[model samples]
Target: MTGYDQILAEVCATGRRLTRAELESRRLLGERAAETGVGLRVLVRQHLAATRTIWPTLGSVDADRVLAAVEQSIDAFAEGHERAQKLAVRREEAARREFIDDLLYGRSDLGRLAERAVRFGLLLTRAHAVAVCQGGTPLDDTDPATRQVESALVARFSERRVLLATKGGLLICIAPADQEEILAHFAKLAHAATDGGRVAVGRAHPGPGGIVHSYEEALHTLDLAERLALDGPVLHAVDLLVYPVLTRDRQAMADLVRNTLGPLESARGGPQPLIDTLTVYFDSGCVAAESARRLKLSVRALTYRLERVHTLTGVNPADPTHRFTLQTAVIGARLLGWPQTEL
Candidate 1:
């Protein structure tokens, strides 16, 4: 029998449990075998050599029978070792999955774990904000430029401790600090990295529990930036408060719109047809025929009114840049109950 099997049988015969010291001694011997550049086969041979000494102390038995039992025990221990290795690997995988989930979902307890991980991995003591980056038009292209940009961000922000994940046309970044210098660095990187790109940045909140919050803010900012057609290489969360204002304080929005455009409303008939044309134009999706039909005027009259609008507002209705401004003004006016003073 193999050494392990013989040891097991001797324990059973003696009705005794091995001490911790004995286990340690055996483990040390195994390690020495490894240190000696011994293969498993050679290690097993050495182990059997030692076992031979112990076997004689037991009552004499057929050498063949002893060898068979020793072989059986060796097989059992190998099986046990393999099972242990599998369990260890499984445990590690589970931990990694749990870590990712916690980072995404914002668990309170997991927040602590995140802090520990960051401090341990990135040497960050505390973080005040997290910034997630959603790749813009140019960055969205699967190219070397994107990877280079990501690498640059990581290297530059190593002190700030940045984590980057780029997948499916999205480049997610987690920036731990909210310092202006750090944010400005990000903006500069973005501007340099992608051509005609856009970046949505979230506001800074308290760190530790702010990763998920920051992610949400980045998403919301991107939506707002896109809707408003804002100029960008960078867009901030604060710039998108107009939509929320429209939703929550319609009267306030209307007031602002009317205050801003009230003069145009009053001057519509006097060299400016802005207020009336805007009302009709927006209502009809800027369609000349529809606006003309609604206003009971010829398309020529509608075009004339639109020209006057451009002159008064200093915004060309046909330009994409002006379209966003017009939309926001129209929405704001609608929300605030416009035409404060009807003509």
Candidate 2:
């Protein structure tokens, strides 16, 4: 508004559109206002106020021409303002992305990371949990589905502590561990928004490094779900902790797999069908009928498969005494990717 009065007076007196230089100056002014956090409405109002002040000063002029000039000036100003705002948003987004990477990966000094977390409305001092959603299609922050989830979560929670991001084509949600509802709601929204993906939640952990651990746990849950053929759409790391312990000793698990089920490889169909029968049987709580139903096999056919397995492996699938060993070996085989990757 400082020099706008003189420009408005010129346009009113001459009954012409704003000169290129004047319009450029107006654009520059708009950019400055945006940079300084001025509202667009306020900027527009100032220009209109200047126009009103100058209107009386002009002895006689075409109202249409003066109106056109003012319109052009304001439009130019708005264009510049919007341009600057967009630039700012991009810069902020980039910073946010960088901070997330460092925070989640523990790539930065803990002190520095904690300070940066504060800027994003996160207090790294409290317990936090990470929930990851892996869908059929890869997703990113810019994806429409991602934005919708982000919007819904923001609208529902309104707590800045909850953050939604995408990493490695997976949707990630971080929320305070104390607020279990936030993570639960996020899992709900993410499952609905994504393409029938599985959502895994890591157990709550305390401190900044805990976030990294939780993120890793969530990621591992997805991996475990695939390896173990888990069908649940929502998985919690806590429920699957035993699997990790079982595989902690790679050699032990491998040896168990090799010794327990290795003989099945010699059976016709190369053990896969037998292995499937065993897995389904164990999963069905050793219920022959349920396992047969799940496998779409006749009861006699499933019984024959189980007998074949027992004959080949020399371990009874039905004996309560042998069930634990057989089940453990089956789990090990899945975890070690035995048949597919070789013992």
Candidate 3:
């Protein structure tokens, strides 16, 4: 028989809902029937009833029996449309997730990226940056912050072009490059939502390959921001570029803190007085008077603290060479969480 007859036979034989074959047949037959000004539903009803009317006329079969057989099949087809629509929706969603996951994880093939890109209505070749929002834990598709970020970005930018995914307890977004304002905008929203958590934005990079680069940048940004305790609702990689290097060698960092500031930290009154004095002294550009004023201490007391620092560490913050070593040590100490966490 025709394509339509085969679809109907299969549905009747298996008692199945509308299959893909049936849906395709409906599309074609519906288009043909529309030429005669008949809607799909009305045409389908007429076609189903034809077996009854035509069989009686040809004196080959009972009208009632044929109508009953085909009419039972109508309900199944009706349910099939909804199932078909849902299936289509689910398939599209799955594909979009795959496209995003593969892109973020750098598993997407460059050759096939163009084809997959078009399927999602996105151009993978555009300049892009990845932003990661580390809010509360157990974050996923249902998280409110994630939902809000997705809604805000897509509302402003468009779903086809942006890839937003929440995995491994973080929300990662890949969007157009130079959208610094957009990244900052969402950062504030997440900040307010989490009562001030961390939001890391990476430097913009070029093309599809750039997505992974940007993702790496964002990850490093977040890591450094946490290590350095960098402030602000939105943290950019550019702001703390030097921090990553400082954090790279944990053993070296501990050694630096131990060798440089370790002596002062062990002073009679604990490290705060010396540490605070050193920090303010460094902040004041090695000016005795200004450092004393900032610390609300007399110049004599500040001098004494500086002398004590030199006495213990054997490096004066005033001597250019000694100051560089001491300053570097102070910074390394902070980054290594020294004193707070035992050298």
Q: Say which candidate scores most in TM-score.
A: 2
User: Which tens-of-lDDT digit does each residue in 15-132 have in candidate 2?
Assistant: 7678888888888888999999999999999888888888887767788877887899899999889989999999999999999899888999999888988888789999999999
Q: How far is 337's C-alpha from truth in model 2 (Å)?
A: 2.2
Q: Cα lDDT of model 1 overall?
A: 0.59
- After superposing candidate 3 on the true structure, give the runs of residues whose Cα lies further than 4 Å from its correct spot: 1-90, 193-195, 248-254, 268-308, 318-321, 337-343
Ten consecutive residues with minimal summed lDDT in candidate 1? 119-128
Write one digit per residue (lDDT tens) for candidate 3, span 1-343.
1354554444445545566555555554444444445544774666656544444343344444445445544544444454555566787878877887787777878869767876765576778877888875657877887787777777876634666777678887766775666666667766676566788888888877787788888888887677555667677877777777876897887888888887775689987679778878887898999999989999999999889988998998879978877887787877777688885
Looking at model 1, residue 237 earns an lDDT score of: 74
TM-score of each: 0.45, 0.94, 0.65
Candidate order, TM-score descending: 2, 3, 1
Error (Å) of candidate 3 at residue 287 is 7.9
Worst 10 contiguous positions by lDDT, candidate 3:
52-61
RMSD to the hidden true structure, all candidates: 11.8, 1.8, 7.4
Expressed as tens digits, the lDDT of each residue in 166-284 for candidate 1 is: 43465555665645566666666665666545666766655455666766777777765564444567777767765665657655666556555655654635422465567677767
Using lDDT, give the best candidate's number: 2
